[model samples]
Target: MPDNGDLRDVESTPLQDTGVRVFAVPPAEGAGPGEIMQGFLEALTSDDPEYDTARKYLTSEAASAWRPERSTTVLANGPSITTDCVPGGREETNSATCVLTGTQVATVDAQQAYRPAGGPYRRKLHLTKNPENGQWRIDGLPDGVVMGKSDFQRNYRSVDKYYYASGTAVGATGQPAAVADPVFVRSKVDPMTQMVRSLLKGPTAWLGTVVRSSFPAGTALQKGVSGLAPDDQNKVTVPLNLKASRVAARTCSEMATQVLFTLRNLAPTLESVELRGAGGDRLCELNEEHAESAAWLGSARSPEYLYFLDGKRRLVRMPMRSTGTGAVAVPGPFGDGGRQLQSAAVSRDERTAAGVGNGGRSLYVSSLASGGSLGDPVLTSAGASPADRLTTPSWDARGDLWVADRDPHRPRLFVLEEGASEPEPVAVPHLSGRIEDARVAGDGVRIALVVAKGGKRSLFLGRIRRGGGDGQETAVDGLRSAAPDLEQVSAVSWAGGSRLLVVGQEQGGVQQMRYVQIDGSALDGPAPGALPGVKAIAASEDERAPLVAYSEDGVVRLPSGTQWQKIDKEGTAPVYPG
Candidate 1:
């Protein structure tokens, strides 16, 4: 909202594109915090980017030192970011300064964990515009608990199309970008009796299921992927590719099934590009070549929730109303009093809901039949106020709610059982810094995963059982698994409790939509052919069909043994007419 000759402005990042003005840089290339402050003060009332001032006053190192890190990636997601912006008119001097309200961590070892990278901490700053740079770059680092640094936002997708954010590496030419909903193509592994018999035929047969034949008669495949034809130049349809064949193999540790998903370009050269994915455990990869698209611009069961990166995809959380009142509306979604459809978690029966967002807290239930008309937001803890925030929530087989407690300094994961009096914290490695994100499995028996200080990320599993003199936190199953493209696991959901969709930070072309599933007990026929364009993964009551929404693609439905298809849209684009 720092408006000035400022040149130009936008949301999230990249306020302006104009180059910096010519000026002398600081004598010290690696100047400290104070020096950076002094130079910024002098550059007040300048054009945006203020390239000239940095050139004249700051050494290349001093100027570039102002970059934001990974931990602070959410800073732009201000505690209270107003959609409205205020224009500049008031005269400024020493009364104002810019503030970075977040934390940072090192990707290396621990010793450096104590070091504060950069931020406003929790203190407010009085900022002034540089008539020259047209920005209010911090004169000095504000005050607060410094966490860590260098998170992976640049590689992350979900960008706003109307106004491109800076730091985005679009194409090799670095030109404008276009997209379609992300598609979630899944290969069923936990095989039914029939599946086991099919696989007996061998590898080629299994591979066929990964890509398979064409769309069925009167199929929505082509229309869903490309949308109404060339008449609408806005059309975006990219091909799908399966580079590796996904298989459920038993690890040296246990008999488990895992599925791996990487960013595979289904399109021909110019039409295709690479993207990033979530960072965490590695799973099996399904390699084939029948692409699908999920658009994010529809409502309810339809393809809505358009993401800048993926085209048409559908992912909708039921209303907070009783499964009886499933007809409720979600305005702007969060922020206001209206109900919000956060991430979804299907119960074994698919009757209960464990989503975290507006209106609802820990877990809520709506009849899958009536879609739970209940309008109350369910909270796991009932002690009035426990001084914690619930986010990225999930559920287990017992209908127990698994949620991560969001606290910069002392974060923990909570378990809310069906009839338990209160939610309890299963001890986790305490991080003096910040606990960014957490997720749980479908069975609800496995341990929770957390991303903490330093790029040194690890998974913690199991209960704090005591055996010897000193009690040690035991290791649970499936924790700290390595991922290919994800910077940090951003989102997690259970697809049949064993299979999962872990959304992470984007980087390079490797991570547009990647997922891994866990299955061990082999039943029968080789899993269903491929299901594509899935952004976020969730399970259905019968396990017959899986609900998926591409981070960029809107929403889609993958039936038991058929190719992917789109569900008709119900809600219109909140921003424009569909």
Candidate 2:
């Protein structure tokens, strides 16, 4: 657990299984090779800042060469060790080799990026009798630390570092949308300082092309500075290298805003951040209020209303901030039922909407105001059946509309820039099968896709890359599985900055709803309780809002700490503004 600058003193207590802090016990005198290996592995999971106790079980040369921070290998379970003595070894010069084996689950690289991995894990530890005290000490081992999944969960925590979306025009908020790049860091090892360093290092490889950091190139913490903590006033001060010393005032404020947002996750009480130049001169200062003006955080902005298709196949909505409110028809041709709709999506600004009509063959964009007229279909699909036509439309913060055409004859994903120009086909490189559903994230840089192949549906996350010049194309690259374990995925929605609410079923199991991270990792909390006959799901980036679902019971919602309750039995295809 993190200590948030509380000055109160507490009584010293013995370490137990409380799961808050773990202290490593030094190896016992005259311990055998097996005991030494066990003690050393256990120490790697402890909260020791420098892993000094773990190094005690290694030879001097091994300790000098070991680099625990190089990487972390996560195994499905604790490693199984087998020891064997060297053959034909002299009695006075006995040597042994210990083999450690397990199943690899994931890995965290030196940059603190977590990637799902699968395969067998095997390593050899060479040990020899220490001539000084005749005790077993390991002389050769793997380069980095290894631990079980449970230990990794207990020792580290996931945090999102914010960055500005690259190459995106300013939205209604008059600023570039903020994108979240999540990474795992040691929980009790000065995480506040660790997160600041990560923020300065820029986004991960997959996200780097679509996001830009405010920090100048080569900017880093001043030499020898460590252990950053908030002051009594709930303010933190960050000192930077010379590279950031000559930045403009606006750039300096942007830099401070990034730090303020990143650190708030670990220390919510933090009120402000101050940036200083290499010469200790104040560069800029920013608070939560000011940070909001620097960049738009989609997750922090709540939707004004919840829109869905009513019983009459007309677009309707209810106030998002209110409960028990009756649904009302929206103020447009869609509300008048001039053209019956099958599905709908509201723009982020709540001023316009896009609906798929004519049994999913045509898509129309209209306003949410009264007397608004419906225009010709901006996009059309040639699928022979309704189930094989256009999917539900989705809007991004930039007001761009995204929808997938499931036409078996010409399956493609299309995007309407500002929801007006001719539909442009978006390339999906390396996609294995036809797309069943597509939802663009609020940041407009990441997209969640449901693809079906061989009668199985899986969830994938792809990065949206736009070409540099005109006449060029936009493509979704780096498609990776977001829910690889599920046998079938029915629906997916962005629930937060780096989280998604997923509806799927595991192999040999019933349907279920859960939250998953973009990196394919499970969230720490319990999933939403079971809801029967769920056809579609909707969630807001603002998690405080209820989770809306279109089920057999009609429109239903799941409030915080409560069971699902019926909202509108007549409503279907519920959605919140993107």
Candidate 3:
């Protein structure tokens, strides 16, 4: 991969030597405070599931209280540590405490969900000599572990866990609508146990509102087992408590499927997921065949072509599923008139499109295949200047069009449902600035809003909650900061059910693109590499799909295993089906 500098810092050197580390086993005895401190941090990057070896550095009391499962913090770099003798000289004059500090880059919770840290983190390590062994051991410290970002990237991995949407009735579609919430977990840890615990804990706060877990409330793993184990036959059994026993056979099977799919990526061994009661009775077994058959909760149905506007200011499409090139102007009334298109969004079905016209003063919709206008300006701005007018338009899976009328005096976010004469205003509670663009996820329950404030921009994730039932217009209940780490977010797109491909500049840094979870945690992987001079970007639910963007070279796409290739040398505003 071409070097693009740190995704979070353009002016700084990129972190190097990200290969997996080989940690030496801790000393059998006589290790000092400094040695223990180093061993402890190294253990965070080790492949040990339970960190059994790292416990040797701590006193018996401290070891029993430390819980590495509480969290895994990714620091900007290896922490700086300093030690000094305790002022009052106890029985052992060599007794001392160590102070360590580092900038926290991100944090992964016990559920494995990743969240970027907002500031620096500091830790204290108190140590005393183990009189019996004459070894300086840690007597007190923080509960969890911390490691450098580069080391964290090499040791951790991002995985998705499946959950069904909330509003969908069970079995409405042979496959219930499923959304994937991505989380980061240690690659060598007992990932199966982590995945199970995450599933039982339900979705993260941001996703909790839109998706529901199959596991029952208060369901938990049987105590006394620190990690899961597989039988000689390779069948891994999951032991659940009594709360899960209340579920019906079919419900239990669905729950098993959730665990099946989530663990499928982590452990590809040959077998099934057997859900067991606390007493060891089998509740249900979800084999590979059964998991494969339950496809309702997933998404892989996007169109094969990416839609954009050609040099002639006309709507066009190019094949995305192939290595082919060239663009075909979609049959439509757009770009046919003296009209000039700014930015546009294609509906999830690819049947219709919403476009910003006349320098963002008006919004219009037209049929893509039928070649006709759906209506006269679905929305128009009363603002005077072009910058104070409407922004790009986007469509959600529910067939509703979303746009922001950035009238300086009356900035508003509006949603236009099919056949609605006037767009209904969607309230964005506690908006810090003017709305620049709005893109709704394919699930139709969340929206990614870019707000410009104080000469800078930031991205926020919001839930789409409708008030009136039936055919009433729905509104955005609230928006929460999605990528609080990115100080000047320029563009964003839903890369997966739980992850977003965000292009933004870090505070006082150059712009770059990275995959970030809705909870504001950057993925513990290599940067998507930089898109030089990129203006906008779009991605599909398939993480493997090539990203299409508009740059100085015109509409371009970074195809797999290749550099950016031009689709239309003179086009702008490239977009894909959400």
Per-residue lDDT of candidate 3, residues 193-308 (tens digit):
87788888898766777788777788898986656756667677888895434879878878888887787667667368888887788888878777656645324555677888
The window of 10 residues in a row where model 3 has the poorest summed lDDT is: 168-177
Indicate the residue-level lDDT of 216 in model 2: 78
The list of candidate 1 runs beyond 4 A from truth reads 1-338, 341-346, 359-388, 430-439, 448-479, 482-485, 496-499, 505-509, 515-535, 539-544, 559-564, 568-578
The TM-score, computed over Cα atoms with residue i paired to residue i, of candidate 2 is: 0.95
Q: Quote the lDDT for 403 in model 1.
A: 63
Per-residue CA lDDT of model 2 for 240-268, tens digit only, reads: 98544479988887888889888988888
State residue 84's C-alpha deviation in candidate 3, in Å: 3.8
Better of 1 and 3 by lDDT: 3
Best by the TM-score measure: 2
Candidate 3 global TM-score: 0.81
Residue 367 shift from truth in candidate 2, angstroms: 1.4
* Residue-wise C-alpha lDDT for candidate 1, range 280-345, written one tens digit per residue: 123222222101111110111222222111112112343221122122222222312233444444
